[model samples]
Target: MRLTRGGKQNAKGAGQEMGGPDKEKLVPPAEGTAVPNGEETAVPKAAEPGPVTEEDRTRSEEGKSAGEGGQEETALAQEDGQRRPDESSLRSQLEAVQAELKSALDQAKEFEERAASLQAERDEWAEKAKIAYEQFLRARSDLDGFRKRTERDLEDRINRGKADLILALLEVLDNFDRALEAAQKTGSAQAEGVQGAYASADSSASGQALQSFIRGVQMIRRQFFETLAREGVEEIPSPVGKPMDPSLHDAVAAQEGGGEHGTVVAELRKGYLYKGMVLRPTRVKVIR
Candidate 1:
C-alpha cells in the first residue's frame, strides 16, 4: 500500500527505536528468495482497520436503523410518563368529587329526617291545641247553661217570696170572711160588735150599723180577690158534685152520700193556684 510521506517517516522512526534497519537500506526482495523467519527486520506500523466489505456495510445500515428505533421508543416512553401523571391527577380529582357528592347526599338525608321530625312535632302540637280548644268550647257552653239556670232560679225565688206574702194575706182574708159569715148568721142585730167607733153607720143603729160594716168587709174581700187575680193567682174550682181528683183535691174525709162514689161530697176549704201547677190542693169530702 502507498503511504504518505509523514506516515513513512513515522514508520522509519519506529523501526530505529526497535533497533531495526534504517528506512533507506530497506530494499525489495529478490525474485523467489526464501525470506528468513526470525532474522527479518521488524517495522512498527499504526494499527488500521480492515477494508469495508458488503456484509459490514449491511450491518452498519441495520445498526443505524436499530439506533433510530431505540430513540423513538425512548421518546414514546417519555411521553407516556408525562401523560401518566396527568391521568393520575385526573383520577384523584374524580375520586374527590365522588366523595363530596356522597357526603352531600348524606347531609341531605339527615336534613330530610330532621324536617320530618319537626313536621311530626308540629302536628302533635296542633292536635293538642285542637283538643284544648274543644274543651274550652265545652266549658264555655256549660258556663252559659249554668248562668241561665241560675237566672231562672233567682227569678223563681223572687216570685215565690211574693206569692208567700199574698198567701198570708189570703189567710187573714179567710178569717175576715168567717167573721162576716158568723155575723150574718147572728142576723146583723148586734150593732155593738162591728160598729165600734162609728156607732151610727146608718140611721137604724141596730141593722144599718152592722150591715154597713159587713158591706165594707165584703168590699175589702172583693178588692183583695181582684188584686190576687190580676197577679195571676186564682182559686181552684171545688164544686160539690164534681168527681174528686187526687191531683187537685185532698180528700180530708170520706162519706156515704147519694152521689156517685169517689165524687166530691163537700168542699171543706178552698185552694189557690198561682199558675197551672197546684199551689195548694182543694180540701174536700168524697162519697165512698
Candidate 2:
C-alpha cells in the first residue's frame, strides 16, 4: 500500500501544523501594489499590542456595561428628586379627599339616624291618635244610645203615672154614678106621691127632702164630669145603633138587636179618651 504526504512540516500527534506560505499567514500587500489576477487580497486586522486573555476581555466588557448602567440610574434619580414635591402634594390631596369622604359619610349616617327616630316618633303618635279616635267614636255611639233610651224611659214613666192617676179618678166617678142612679130611682117614685099631694093642697116634708137630695146628687155628678173635661179627659161615644169601633169599644155581649151586624147595640160601661188616645175601652153589646 502507498501512503500520501499531506504537508511539508511533519505534525506531531495532530497538535501543530505548518502554514502554507506567507500568503496563508495573512500578510497585507503594500497600498500602491496591484493585486494578482484582478482580485484584491483581504486586508489584515492590526494585531493587539498586548496579548489579551479571555478572562481579561470578559472583565473589560463587564466594566463597560456597569458604567453605562450607573449613568442611567443617576439620571433617573435626578428626575425623581425633581418631582418629589409634586408627589408629596398629591399624597396630601389624596388624604384630604379621604377625610372629606369620611366626614360626608358621618353626616349621612347622622341624618339617617335622625330620620329613623322621627319615623318611629311619628308612628307612635299616629297609633295614639288612632286609639283616641276610636275611643271618641265609641263614646259618641254610647251617648246616642243612652239619649234614646233615656227619652223612651221618660215617656213610658209619664204615661204610666198618667194612667195611675186616671184609674184612681175613675173609681170615684163610678161610685158617684151608682149613687146618682139610686137617688134618681127613689126621687121618681116619690115624685108621683108629692105631685098628687101638692095638687090637692101641700107637699110632704119627706118628699121635698128626697127631691132636694136627688137634685144635689145630680149637680155633684155634673161638676165631677166638668173637672174631668178640664184635665183633658173626654168620653168615647158608644151609642146604640152606631158602628162598633174595636179600637174604642170592647164587646161584652153579642145579641140580636135593632141594628146591623157588627154594630153597637148598647153601651154597658163608658170609655174615656185622654189627649186623643184611648184611655179605656167602652164595654158594649154588639148586634150579631
What's the CA RMSD for each of the models? 12.8, 14.5
List, residue by residue over 1-288, the lDDT tens digit for candidate 2: 111132111222122323322232345678889888967578645322233345555556666677888998999899999899899999999999999999999999999999999999999999999999999999999999999999989977887788779878887887887887887787777667667434443446666787788788788878987987887789887567888888889999998766689888778888899868888889899888
- Writing each residue's lDDT as its tens digit, candidate 1 over 19-84 gives 665343434455676678735444444433234445555666677788899999999999999999
TM-score of each: 0.52, 0.51
Model 1 RMSD in Å is 12.8
Clashing pairs in 2: none
Q: What does the lDDT read for residue 182 in candidate 1?
A: 79
Model 1 ranges with Cα > 4 A deviation: 1-89, 92-96, 116-163, 173-232
Deviation in Å, model 1, residue 156 alpha carbon: 5.8
Worst 10 residues of 2 by lDDT: 1-10
